[model samples]
Target: MKFNATLLAQFFHFILLLIFLRIVAYKPVANMLKSRQEFITNNVAAAEEDRKQAEALRQQYLADMQKAREEAQAIIQQATKAGEVQAQEIIEAAKTEANRVKDNALQEIAREKEKAVAELRDQVASLSVLVAGKIINQTITPEIQHGLVQDFIKEAGDLPC
Candidate 1:
């Protein structure tokens, strides 16, 4: 074969093949590649949106848990305060009852003291009348008996009961 002629023919043939492939397959293959790129971009954007929504939901759940914990603490504090108030009320009631009982006991003691004093006066009066009758051997007038009893009480006034 002649070298120059063969090289020239091969070059012409390579140029024609490039032109035919550009017309037949280049545009379709480039369009397919662009469509695939768009599909990948759309999928990435959707995944990013989903991630953001998941983060928002997680934040909302954390906020709800914090609010619930605060409410529970408030309820516990209220219960503790109520219990303290109840205990204070019970203590006050017990103190009031104790005071009432003490007053009643004091009044009973005073009444008993008065009854004993009255009975002792009666006995002293009877003894004074009997002694007067024995000393004079006569019945004493009521006025004289009264005077003797009064004098005896006066003399005994300085003595302890």
Candidate 2:
């Protein structure tokens, strides 16, 4: 084998060039690409975590909203029941008042009836006495007077007077 100086020199130059490229460009580029990949992976992981947190928050909010709705419905139902009870009590009170008024009216009517009956009896007695006095005054003869007196006594005895 013949060793050539030109080929040896050329070979040395190529090796130096490769070393320079590796030092100046390849290594830095590879490192940059690796860093970029790591950054992208970290970002993806962070995004997934954020998404999971957001989903959890959404579920919690929905649960809270459902609980609030149920509580409101319960409160409304309780209020409705209480209102119904109050209404029933009011109706009962009204009925009681009506009964009392009816009883009072009946009592007043009975009192008035009693007063009317007593007045009628008094008037009848007064008229009967007046008629008897007129008949006795009209009798002037002794015999008629004696007979009239006897009749008046008998009639008066038969009455309440």
Candidate 3:
């Protein structure tokens, strides 16, 4: 091996360059990479926490919807029951009114029938009295009047005097 000053100086210069690059560029680049890795890890963890919170909120919304639906169904059922009750009440009231009207009509018919019968009886009595007076004036004898009266009575059947 031949010792050359120029070769040694070149070698030494290359070592100094490597040391300077390590101190100035390599360390700074390595620190920057480490910091970037930490930032990425923290961001990933925060994103995972936010995803969990969103999932919880979604579940809560679904539960609230279910409760609202149940309440609406209950209200509908109550309204249906109330409507049925009202309908039944209306039907009962109508039936009662109809029965009352029918009873009133029957009573009115009975009163009319009785009034007609009384009027017919009054006319019959008047006609019978007029006939009796005529017979009394024409016969003028007690025996004939008595016999005619008996015959009239027999022919008239059960009519009142």
Rank candidates by TM-score, best first.
2, 3, 1
lDDT of 1 by residue, 111-153 (tens): 9888878867876677677666755985678987787777777
Local accuracy of candidate 3 as per-residue lDDT tens digits, 71-148:
999999999999999999999999999999999999999999888789768866876887678786885588877877
Candidate 3 backbone collisions, by pair: none
Rank the models by lDDT, top first: 2, 3, 1
Global fold similarity of model 2 (TM-score): 0.69
True lDDT of residue 90, candidate 2: 100
For model 2, give the 10-residue run with minimal summed lDDT: 152-161
Error of 3 at 58 (Å): 0.9
lDDT of 2 by residue, 13-120 (tens): 999999999999999999999999999999999999999999999999999999999999999999999999999999999999999999999999999988877876
lDDT of 2 at 16: 97
Candidate 1: list runs displaced more than 4 Å.
Answer: 1-29, 127-161
lDDT of 3 at 55: 95
| TM-score to true structure, per model | 0.64, 0.69, 0.69
